[model samples]
Target: MDSCEEGKGIRTLSTVCEAAETAGIHMVPNNPVQVLRFSEAINGNVRLLELNPEVEKSLKQGDRVVIRGLASDEAILCTESKSFEVKVVETSNTMLLCRDIQTPGKEAFTASQSAGGGLIRQEVCGSACSYLELRPCRGHLSRLAEVLSEHQYAGPETEPDNFVAGYTFRDLLDLVQGSEDELWTGLKRCKACCIDGFWRLLSADYFEQAFDRIVQSLAEKDWPIYEVPVDECCELLTDLLPRVIIEHCLTCYGKKNDNGATYCLDEELVSQFYAGYLLRRVAKFNYAEFMEVWQQTVPLGITVALEMLKGIALHDLTARPPVVWHFPANSLPYDVSPRFNALFQERTKWTLSDLRPYIEDLATPQQPLEAILLKHTRSTMDVTGQKLYNSRHPL
Candidate 1:
């Protein structure tokens, strides 16, 4: 064995090359250069390993040959069973390089762009949609209904039943804009008829003349004249006119009904000739005051009236005033009272002329006819404990 000790305590040249062959040292085919493990004894020695194949073949047995130009940490072993040993010289310059990089797919990239665009579109659409909602004028339809329901004096009803059908507030406004002349004509006739009805109710005796004057006035004003359907006009007239008369009677005399009798007059009904007489007189010069009184006092009087009518009880009249008396009497004689005579005289005098302006004034403030009817109907029911006005049965 060619044994030798090298730098850094390395041992070299052992008796058996079996271990070296098992370490994977091998020769490349068609190449004279031999590859083997690097050892410290080969340091600074280049000529032996780099020698041509001819010189390697001529090397004598037991010669001390040192390998060169190899890395210090390199190791190789023989692939074959033979104990052939060779020295490593140079290595190949090829190297492997690894790295990581990310790339987005086509679908992912498109979706990102689409999401950004959709957000912008939604914002623009929201801003534009805010102003597109509908906004209507308040009480417009209510006013139209009031005018249509009140106007009683147009010659016989001329328009089709469908004239006011399907009429919304928007439709009424459109109608007002489109045919203002027609609307105004309708309004004027309605106002005239309402005034006429109001006067007649206040004083039943003057009803005929009051109605004629209303028509004549409308004709003079060039308002289209047509007679309203009797059925349609009757209930409205009854409600409005009777209330007016009742209010006038109540204010003129602090009296209330009792057992089919006018305040002081036992033989007279409150609604008979005396109501007309009082309407003609008291409601004549002070029309506005009469209307104010009606509006304020009629509701209360209706409550009282209904109660009295509902609760009739007999009582002795030994100490009461008389039934027959002159106008403006302080008291009635013979079972009648002074207050009753005064009320009868006051309420009977109101004529159409006396009540016209108030009706006109009342008519000017437009309200939804249905809503007005509902309110008045509720009031009547509340006072009378019965439905006096039925919208379903308007007549």
Candidate 2:
């Protein structure tokens, strides 16, 4: 009878021979070539094992294969993927700031609003979204139903109203004077007539800034007016003013339809442009995270991307004052904030206006937007000319 050691040796020999056979090489009679054990790591702890010279010889550089060590015959096959860590030496402030300010949540919130409020969260700062995702929809009706059920206002005689008793629009306006969210909340609580009136005031391009007209008309009409108050109104003004500017500029960015007079915002083109812009601007931009945020808030991909670019550009232009050109202080707009005017007081200043022409050129496609964006993506790589350029992916 064979000893236990002899049996173990026989099994080892059997495994080696089997592995050799699987690799399409036959062992010489009473002769076994040494097995060259190879552990090629694919990713993380996962590895690709090549047990014999025959197996290694059969594999193309990137070919996938099933492999087993001598211990057992069970094998795992995986495609060999090469990984490399890419490092960017010098950090650009433009890219860094872009990454910092690309607030996906904020952009999403803005999208919910723009999409006629399609998203409704119970803890949202404001009111409900509509069924059709447009204003004046059945979505508000659902909210009304909830409110009625909560108040037990079920009787036929109980008229549906948005009135907050003992609170005049003026008084409520006073209460919400400090907060944008409060203003919107108060607006939600007001009677339907008041909400409609307040909306009208905003909708009219001419009446937008005519505060006296807005207030006096609501008061005279006896419409319960809920509005952003004087202090908080400044914040709304900044938002509103930029929105108007962007809407107007967006016209220039669109393509004229076959009819020539009508314009269509080439949503895909705009998205590509925005992607480029994001890549150019945001150094540590994560595509997955950005897409996730964007999907929830504003699935209208192009519009949201355009808004993001607009918001960033407007902020950059407004925040620290212009550094591009020099202009006299006296020539600047007088009613502007003294602090803003002060940016130009001492030096010949390139104002926001000066930057407009360049922005317009870029928008119209006269300038290569991709090149500018690529410059940003390329900045992160040690090499140039489109070599493995992923800003977010390390490998």
Query: Top model by lDDT, which number?
Result: 2
**Any runs in candidate 1 off by more than 4 Å, and if so which?**
1-126, 129-138, 141-395
| Cα lDDT tens digits for candidate 2, 287-357 | 44554443443213234542433212222233243211222221222222332333323222323343222
The lDDT for every candidate, in the order shown, is 0.28, 0.31
- As for candidate 2, its clashing pairs are 162-191, 325-349, 325-350, 326-348, 326-349, 326-350, 327-348, 327-349
lDDT of 2: 0.31
RMSD of 2: 29.4
**TM-score, model 1 to reference:** 0.16
| Counted clashes in each candidate structure | 45, 8
Candidate 2: TM-score?
Answer: 0.16
lDDT, candidate 1, 80-132, per-residue tens: 11111244334344221112111234453345454541111111111111111
